[model samples]
Target: MNLSKFDFTRLKNLLPSSLKSLSINPTSDLIREDENNDTEFYSTPRFVHHIDDRARYVLSQFYTYAIQQTPETITLDLCSSWTSHLPENFIGKVFGLGMNELELKENPSLNQGYTVQDLNQNPSLPKFSSNTFDSVICSVSIDYLIHPLKIFNEVGRILKPNGLFITSFSNRCFPTKVIRKWLYMNELQRVEWVANYFLQTDTYFNPMTIKAYSFFDGNFLPITDEHYVDPMYIVSANKK
Candidate 1:
């Protein structure tokens, strides 16, 4: 995609009011924790789901629909874990690229292959050739990326033309690992931030769409009840 042809005005108009006011300082210190080593942070494998059950279900529903919409036979799960949330009937080969080998090995969906690599240290996926995947997904883990734009561009390069790149997140994250921009922004603003990633990278098709699904009674509002449900948000775009 041509960077000059990007319609920033149209993209800005589509964003929420909160996102319009937020600014991204690319030079800022994204990681707040004392430990910068992601390997150490994720050293002990936690065989557990990050989000709640309801949020997982919503994510699964979205993933199922996304896979059905496209001809995705080979999928790459970036920053993946033990569970990929793919539909049981999905007949595709899912590959896992994550920090922990144990987590990737535990994932049943990654029957095709799996690799242990840190995107923060190296954003590029040199192992895979260009246009190797039909779809790329990063579930509930976008906030941890310090070099998100580089990773986004890598996603564009590896995906076939018109292939889908789906990024889903929720209210939960390791506070120290999340970037300052993501940690400071509200849920709506964070949606725009992810959209800006797709736009600024100049790798995705125009008119990036953002969708929010609340775990609280299916309403868009955040869950304020005692049950403590996490609200899910998705920002998706097609490779140009």
Candidate 2:
């Protein structure tokens, strides 16, 4: 959908009046089109990139730029899969959490190890210790999270002081799995929605939103693209 033509006023009118005065806190907003067991839905190990090559390159470059200050970084890849999408120069020890063990094991970027857990079913990270990781990254998978606030809290618990929690998403997703709220939002609103998640967490600070691709036009980036390029947005914050 062209963001410029989206009916934001209609969407706002459709929302509960309380939501207008509050953050993204409605439980109904998290409902998915497909409520079937997520484990079963993701049981098949499909090793594929959700975003295109150019978008992937942009994500890798963003990762490199984001994690450059932290040395010997211990990172967590949330909602991870067959690839963590870390830059080639990244030497960080990475742990992955996902629904498919086969895919997680196949991720070369997960140098430390991998765990198979459905975050939608269990938002807790009981296996990880507090302040254990220097960074946590979720790529193109945040839209599918049903219990995002809980997961964000877990990310804060697992991250060290000043640790980075970075999430990036493109104009692509498993439509049936994505939350209903995400479907109603345009690109700019989606960024605000993510930024609000960080704000509500309270444990995170200095939240930053970026248009990782040149095609995006949001509060963070006002550029437009006529070419057929995948648009990507990034929302990142530091653990307080």
lDDT tens readout by residue for model 2, 67-119 = 74345779999999998889876876888999999898888888888889989
What's the C-alpha lDDT at position 192 in model 2? 66
Measured with C-alpha atoms, the lDDT of residue 225 in candidate 2 is: 39
Which regions of candidate 2 deviate over 4 angstroms? 1-22, 69-71, 204-227
Candidate 1 stretches greater than 4 Å from native: 1-23, 69-72, 208-226
Local accuracy by lDDT, each model: 0.76, 0.77
Candidate 1 lDDT over 8-83, as tens digits, reads 2232333553333234576684555644688888988989888887778777766776663334479999998888
Clashes of 2: 0
TM-score of each: 0.83, 0.82
Cα displacement (angstroms), candidate 2, residue 182, comes to 0.5
